[model samples]
Target: MERRSNKADKFKYLQPVDRAAIALMLVLIVLIGLLIWNGDRTAPRVRNFSWQNQQVGAEDTSFTLNFNRPMDHASVEANLQIDPLLPGKFSWAGRRMAYTLTAPVFYGTNYKVQLQGAKDKSKTESGKENEKLIDPFYGQFSTRDRAFVYIGVEPQEKGRLILYNVTQQKKTVLTPADMAVNDFKIYPEGRKILFSAADWLSQKPGVFEQQLYTVTTGINPLSPGKPETKPEAAGKINLVLDSKNFQNMKFDLSPDGQAIIVQRVNRNKPGEFGLWVIKPGAPPQPLENQPGGDFLITADSGAVAVAQGQGIAILPMTPKAKPLDFLAQYAKVFSFSKDGASAAMLKFNTNYTRSLFLVTNQGVQKELFKTTGSILDAQFDPRSDTLYCLITRLQKGEQDQDQEQPLLATVDLKKAKMTPILALPNQRDIQMSLSQDGLALLFDQLVTEKKLPKTGALTTNDGQAIVNSLLWLLPITPPTEGSKTQQQQPQQLPLPGFRPSWLP
Candidate 1:
């Protein structure tokens, strides 16, 4: 009875303040529960991020990412940043997002990405706001090692194949001083190099007695104070094809390193020049009805493109693949896209002018540029859309033609615009080399006999200019390049060399 009376008195005499306090406590609990629910809805998390393909040679075209909650499309686009700052577009399907690189990513570079200004767009059951700001997300990836090889152009460094480190700014000559290397190509592994060299053992060789040979590009040419213990043994040079039977003059190694295509000139018949495909330890097979000059094997190794009598033709690796006629009117197929889908070609427009066109795989040709300049060389950018060329425009003179300046320009296929990247005067014997990554280019300037310096770094006392190649590098996509408000010139490497090529 007493406990009942106390309980009854506690409820009976309870002030309005007590009742209000109980109501406030209930409301607080409800508010706290609502806050937790809102947090769960607002929190956005990255579920997965990955590359779609692993066979990307130079640069990947696109990538994908997924999140736990729907994202604000505008916010994601505004906040996303790709290191090396590649231009790209973003698309979203539900919680997953895809990014397509507008300009293909540069090869041999590390890319870091961050998504800072993203927000979640989730729904709440109570019809309340479920918006939440996400934490910054980060990821990083690399394309491949940036590597290149160059032919020594100076007198002392003549005919030497040198492996250069683009990042480290160091160099190591890969060939021996005894042999003279004429033309070379790096295998896909970047460790082995296939080259044609003068055969010293030949009985009575021609002017350029070149034979097929390969050497290890990974060997360290220098040792600690002492000479390489066994220089010959350490040098992994193997005789693939000897020059005894045929004059193996020019050659190109396939990207897969499975076979080599050599433009052979028969020693017996002075006029007989043929194309042969040779494999290690296997007899060389001749391609019938194929007359070759400046030939290149396709990226897939399924066909070969040769500059024949009239035009360039794509002859299949097997006869049944059928021949594809390309550039029927052009004299040469200067360069092919990385995937062999497009080509850069040059045709004579008039006696003094040339027309450069970008030809697609489907026989579609687009006139990139037509100018009165002599197109010394033209190449397709790795992306298969842009084109770069080294053009020398004649300012005056009928025969010699006092040139105004050598112009290095890039043609944007999308906009049909020509932008000059460089302008230099009096650069002779210019040859351009683009890295497999398509991030850099190399060329050499000719040092003529009369203009030779007294120091004679690459000159003879007789005032004859035989060896004059000054190597220069122009970085199109440096991994850590800063903003460019003005034009930048290519840096000249102190080492005198030329005919540079990037390794895949």
Candidate 2:
């Protein structure tokens, strides 16, 4: 039998170059093993922070922290700290930790985050704990400035969209001169404004001929204080829906800024009133449901709440879709929370009294309070536990509609307490808006005149006649324990405008 060559005898015939190459490969494997072992024993560090030096928006509800090594979830969560007290939940995936906010952060606030004593999840080969502490990390972020948009009532800027930067003390006109803006809604990003306008120079400049258009706000959401640079000029105008066959009525811009919900009536058939959606790159389409009164596009931008007969109907935006849910108790839906969890609504009682209710998605209807006067509008604070309402209270011994005084009130949802903030006597058809940070309130007070202006009669969004309008800003301060409720006063903004609204 032939003698079999042993493994050592076969390798003895190898060249010197090949033997050296094998030795180099063995050394590389040992080096790699040593490197991995050292890496596991080293201290963990934050490799990336999602909101590092970034400016966030309302839609930015969560941030992420990436680590260089696997980390102990409990230790990381316990050591994570955010300044100014932002309530949120922590989640982990491998070495990444995510913090999701329970609610939108207050606008115009600078937030700081720090993590010092987080431990890693590494272990020794013998199954012994060998966790390493994470390196100290600090990060910061900021929100956009406090800003608002209004319809300029001044003679030179009449019927124009005016953007006022409350933080910077700057004002800029966003619309052209020849077009008369009817009504407008700003996009959630604050980069564009959707409005209805008509040719003011034309003799037939009527509301029936109004057309939907969008104009550039030039307010960059990323770098808020800096103007947006683009190929098109700032304040560029683009026509969206025209009033060729249907007249555009009250309209709302979707929170995502992808679509517009506008009430329109057929030009030929005045009785045919319905809601139409004008989406970008698509023609206007009508919802298959019946025409309803005073509608609002929901926060999710997927449905709409319309005031139908004796109740409010929540209908999906899709054509031919059935109603998502019909709230037979609520007669009017005013506003929804940022997360779309709660809505401020109105219920009409048989005794002619209207009750404001905080309707939640969790099948809970909380009755805030009842008022004999009408509830013009209500807005939920970013915190969702506070509500600001613009309501009318019947004056003593007066039942006339004009005798109703507008009162700005705040309701603490948790404590079930209602506080009157401001009393606007002789202010009719007044409009109020709450800031994103829940720190300021804006409302317009119109000054009536015996005679109309020489240019023409200026009217509000509600079609009320007015000579001039005054914008007022009221700062909202949290009530402290043992502190008296002092009457808060609003400061006039020196802006001659109506329908003042805070930018998103």
Candidate 3:
């Protein structure tokens, strides 16, 4: 006991520098303890904050942003901002904030929304603040494309009906503006476009009615003051067969380019329209006499399929073979298969209920799924045997007389099912034409109001003002599956005009 007491006393007599060093070590330990206590008492860190349910062209809109923990509603709403900054008219549903845009967006316009000063509600006792979270979100929705086909409208001017490539970002006007264009078709080799145009001898009315014109793919348009190089202009489009009203007149060039099958209207008599096989440079020849309406040429060998009132018939390419009765009494043909072995037809019951059908060999027919509304038009992809159709449905408060919104759907024969290709909400009057490869779709989406109650009463507004008709190319192969559905988005091609007919 005496020796221990002596040792403790000796340590107490240590130097001032040693005492100071011990004091410093004790202070450092206390500081470390304080930091650990502060960290433990703080709130959980917030992370993975993001938005959801975001789309460009949707009418009903909602957004969902996540937080590390349940957030204070006022704080979250205060941080959310949409620009052209929207006014305070939104409602919050739990963690989601929803609001309808008061103003309709213009076509081809881009929009943005910003979130600022977003943070967790939890705070430290020392009054220190956490890192403020912030981000900006952007999206673009385009207005409906225009309808380029001048159906039911007369071409008044003698200028070239230049079919510009509107699908490209850099606008390339493809057709030359030398002569007036009548009904024209792109050549089987897409390099050359074949159209009928008329040279206007005078500025008199009806002088520029019909003319034949052709322009190669890469030909340059003649500029002012440049030497006038006469582009190869074919002669007038001679009236092969004239009709009183050429409603729904359709024409298809054969694969060999030797003949064109046309749905010609015989104006001299009622119900006189019929299918005619005509040589482009030679005289016209008549095919099987059928009620002339819409017709499609087979993708494989140019066999003609004509749609009558209630049924469809396929005229064989061989001169000796008789026309094959392919469809049933209830089915009508709209499109043909690649090999012309099958056709997409609409099946109707006695009650006028309609369903889609794919007619095949062995007299087999499969019904496409029942649609939500009436199916207006259907097209078959000769390459893939896929059927594309346009469906229309009336909106709320829209009567049977009102124009309906059009939707596009694609039917996969392998799956024996249908999938919606596009849901056009703003579109009023819609018309679509598909390319041969099944990759491109030319559509005229009308935004103007259509004349209703056609009792021959002449009530008129500003004539059908076209918005913008665009051609979009969508890939059909590699069917979209699972999470790869994003690849199904249509690739827009630059086209001068909307209606694009693929070459053979």
Candidate 4:
């Protein structure tokens, strides 16, 4: 009787405590379940952004956004806004979203991107209670300044490569007094420049003693509008190819800065002329055994286009490699698109006229327009749908004298439409360069005289005695309705230089 009573008392106390613990556990479980089910009501946030206070370039065509939670693609795109109205396409990959620009961004510009009023994936899919909006996101970015380098025509800084900042009034001399810079090409990154130079004090001809070199531009495109902070690496020159055994004629730096294509003629044997390629830290290698005319390296740096026997041969960059493609109708390639998919080429027809053709790598050749005068140069816009050509047309002036007038024209590749942007009367042998953003054009107007017999004076690239040279900046704008000419006027820069080229 005593044992039964003790066991009953213990069971009675344990049963009450066990019931209380079970009830508490059930309450906790229910609370956790409710929290888990309502988690979709939490606000969505942008975890990371690609262009947050970053400096971008033409190569940076796309940006991405990583979200903390899955987002509704349609709502996010509809809520996103970019300043200056950059046109692009959007793509989604799980929690990440990307925006790819259809055209290149403008240089020396400040941009802002904003996003708001977007919903989470769960709230968007299901009509659930307590729906929440995503947190507002904002981003900022800037581009590099508009800058160029040219040969100084002034007597004090003659034969020197000078860098002039168009955005900021800053100038830096890039060559020493002993070296005379001839021609130069900027690297794609704008960090270095490849140029040809000669000893200024040597009694021999500058052409015979020409050597190849690279100089640091000391430009930091990342920090736009601040030339004062970017002052390092100026006037730092390195020898690339020496002219001890051969004479270097025409040379081109690859767009990727990996290879250099140069035309050379052997010193000992005048008949031996060919093309040579120099890689990074490697010796010069012969590309072909014969000579070519007006050669240029492709944008991809995989091949070179050479004008050969009334045709253009696209030869691979390797040694002794055969031609990759050949076009028998075009005489020369003026410039290539940024993607390396299209090119602006020149064709010399038998009817005493030249035609500008838009040639694609897919073997599509469309003639943009035909001109009866000479085609000086051509450049493709960033969109690859417009071509800017510098050509000449015959005009009668002053007692019916035939004059070659230079005209700056833009051709729409899709519509085959030609519009005359600017006409330079009494201008001959002019040089032009297009800006990276396709917003402006740089050209030089030179006043020249006949060269003296044997004077140690300065002369332009075309052997003209340069009296004065002016640099003009023309803003590229569309023609107004019912008007045939652009209303924007050309602004003359306060720099005295010739053969001006924008830093890439």
Candidate 5:
């Protein structure tokens, strides 16, 4: 009886151990099932996404992207990139991500905003193993094609003006190298480009000046392996009526390519520049008796426009004839109409509060537009009835800042009314030029922050600022009345005959 009782006790003790192991197994199964269920429920999936503002090419622009769920900031930043490597910053609000980029973006260049390898944050109950997520996301978008124009600039290094064919699918350098070109004019035929380059003779170190050179499309084919050719001089480009100490420079060309206007700078005077004209292949004739500055010539007609101290004068093409007595006081001519019947002038007081006026032959100086900011640059369309001007507004409370301007505005003139077309990014030293078809604009966008003058004490004393300028082309639609709808179309042809100096 004692042996049997001992065996029974051992069996009872083993029974408790068996039950405890069974209970532990049950708990493990439950935990595994819960993990499986949560993993299936919380699998990452992408939600719908869109650009913050669909309107592309707007100045000082931003883009927003939506996501299915809150994203890990590190993951998103690791995946996001804007081509051309624009200076930008990224921020997130709720399920949306915003990116703000700096300008001057090449107007028609295809820009890709890419988001790759982004992952969502794991749920709290996803367990410790799910702490780090591996799911990724991707998105891509291109910028709009409108508001792009071609801009050209003359670099001092080689005296070569870089002409960027903004709309061309392939990059083509319109102007060749080894030329000493400064200011240029585009021919009305759109087949030729003209500019004043130091004559081959003047290219030598001791030479004082140069003459105008013409590069014809038919003459200079820009094909590979072809020998580069020099631009032929159309006629004599020299000072005809200036003090021997003054330097003569070509200013503009007539539309028919028959006449050229020249500006003579007086060496002794601080602000003295004189105007003259000569028929191509003929002798030069004086247009103004006294010092004048900033002159423009009509392409269609041989009419000459000159700006004196707050005054403007129009001279007929007749050689050695007195200028027509249509003096505009307190006004400066910016551009002339296609028919040379009207002029676009900026009227300003001593303080420089400016108003744009359309002056007609009928003695009508109508105030087409007024602005609190100063007009930096202006150009007339091929039709001459429309004017495009760049205006700048000073930023508030930032008056002491070296670069305090906040905005650049484009003003349009039509039917005696002035309208604001678009405002550009903050830039300085702005310049505007329109293509012959009026579909493109070439302008300079000042890269202000990057344009810090690299001048030493001696350089500053020499009156030279070390600033870099970038040229850009903006594509635009002609302003049509009552049509708020405008579309940017890619340019099909090279920008030819766009600059006034290139006009034949």
Candidate 6:
């Protein structure tokens, strides 16, 4: 009956090495089973989420999230929440995800977020999946604090630098009574303003005596509801530099707030224009061979883009001075991206047509749009993939033959779609700027002053023959294609000025 051939009898016939191998296999299988069970019990967690509830630059910021485990793609999207409800799209890569804001968030505003009901891709022993519920992930950051614009209101404010608080919508004048600030830029920290102004002490009619000056902007002087004392009136204005032989025409502040690039004209030798690099507490040095026109400082502060007779050349700020010719074929560069990463170049062809091209950092030119009329100005939007452009389009109506009307258009860089935002019929010297948070757009639309009978020229009320500008603050709300032009009119703030610029 073979009663002795039971389990023990079979094991006794096996070798010691075979028994050891079987035990090792059992241990490996048990370990794997434990790991699977632990994984199923633990829900995915957001290791670090960025770009939420904080002040960011006017440039469009993309949200980045890192996860501890694999997440369900659909579940994560559905569970994500942003409040006050910013519109954005999500891009996922396994445990990492990015969310790009469709429109830039308003400056100095609190933004909140919540991510709930996100489930892991794995299942548990009872066939239950782990669901992660993240509440109020990363807190917010603030954008730049305030912006400065010049107001040339005569008898009172003539080329006066006005600081407008984005959060409170408050205004404070920073220049003295007779300083006559021509052009200015806010420091990155929003504390001080570097401005070029006509020196009242050395004033000579028709002889242009401008000097560099700086005024504090970060002081809080509400003064218990005293209407906020003017910074200039508070003795905050101080002379930074008294020019002896050069006049600072246009200047750009570095994004890092370390240096300044100025387009200076030699007073002794008229028409001799050059570039000056300045660091605070140190004397400025002239950069040789730099053509004087509109200039911009690169983000790294290692180079500057100067509009020269030949074209825009990026001159490196080094001992060995060699410039890289950029966009030499274009007639003008309407604007450069914040970091000098891209530029809006205009090409004037022999056929009498002008086209606007978006030049990237890789030296690739992506033709944005072209027209037979004209492209007055084009600026890259700091926040998102958008552009604020001023163009004159020829009228196609029957009664308006050969008539062209200037219009402010917003172009979405991703879609190449242009939408008219404002009609600039008689708005001359139209200077436009976007706030650091990308939520507000400020533009000065000046109507030419009536020509004097004797002078036969338009003159500013400041006793100078210059165009007086009206400052308009437009809340950037991109409308659809079929929207009426009037619907896009921005909220016109009471601040009027020229050469409007936001703090970094």
The CA lDDT of each predicted structure is: 0.69, 0.81, 0.50, 0.82, 0.54, 0.67
Best by TM-score: 2
**TM-score: model 2 vs. ground truth:** 0.88
Least accurate 10 contiguous residues by lDDT in model 6: 453-462
The sequence of per-residue lDDT tens digits that candidate 1 reaches over residues 339-451 is: 77777777776466788888887868888888876777877766335677888766775687576568888887777677778875465456787766556777776666555
Off by over 4 Å in 2: 1-16, 32-39, 81-85, 125-128, 201-207, 223-233, 396-402, 450-455, 478-488
Give the candidates in order of TM-score, highest first: 2, 4, 6, 1, 5, 3
TM-score of each prediction: 0.69, 0.88, 0.51, 0.87, 0.52, 0.70
Whole-model alpha-carbon lDDT for candidate 2: 0.81
Give a tens-digit lDDT track for model 6, residues 1-504. 376667778888889999999999999999889986676445467887565434465554587888887878887899787767677889988899889876666655566666777776776567676455443354444444555545555456655777776667777777777676666777654567777777444443344567787788754322111243444332277876667878766678777677877777787797787777788687887787746466777666678776776567788754238886665766676777776778787787779878788888887888787787788788776656778898887766667567667788877776777787678754335567776655567777665545441222223324344555567777755444565223445665566556677665
Query: Candidate 4 residues 1-504, lDDT tens each?
Result: 999999988767787779799889999999889877655456899999887777677878899999988888889999999997788999999999999998778877799989899877764334653445789998888877778888777777777899987777789999886677778989875888899988765413344577999999887555332232455577899999999999998899898899999999999999899899999978999996346799999989989999988789999988889888888878889999988999889999989899998899898999899988788898988855778889989889799988788998888899878777789746777889998877788898888777551334445656666677788888876333455335578899888877889876
Pick by TM-score: 2 or 4, better one:
2
**Clashes within 3 Å, all models in order:** 0, 0, 23, 0, 23, 13
lDDT value for model 4: 0.82
Residues 196-313 of candidate 2 have per-residue lDDT tens digits of 8887643131446778888887766554233445533458898898888887888987788988888988888999888888787887898868888888889899899999997889
Error of 1 at 141 (Å): 2.5
* Model 4 pairs whose backbones collide: none
The digit string of per-residue lDDT tens for model 5 on 1-504 reads 999999988767787778789889999999889987665445444464444223233222566667666777777778776675655678888877777654333344455565656667665563453444434444444433322222233342333443333344333234444444545665533345555655333444323364555554332222122244664432223332333566666577776667777776666783765676767567676565555666677545657777766587667866556777656564567776655677778788566567877777788778777766777666666522566677776565565653435333344455566565556656554556665445566654443333333312001111333143454455666545466425453332333221212111
In terms of lDDT, the best-performing candidate is: 4
- Compare candidates 5 and 6 on TM-score and give the better one: 6
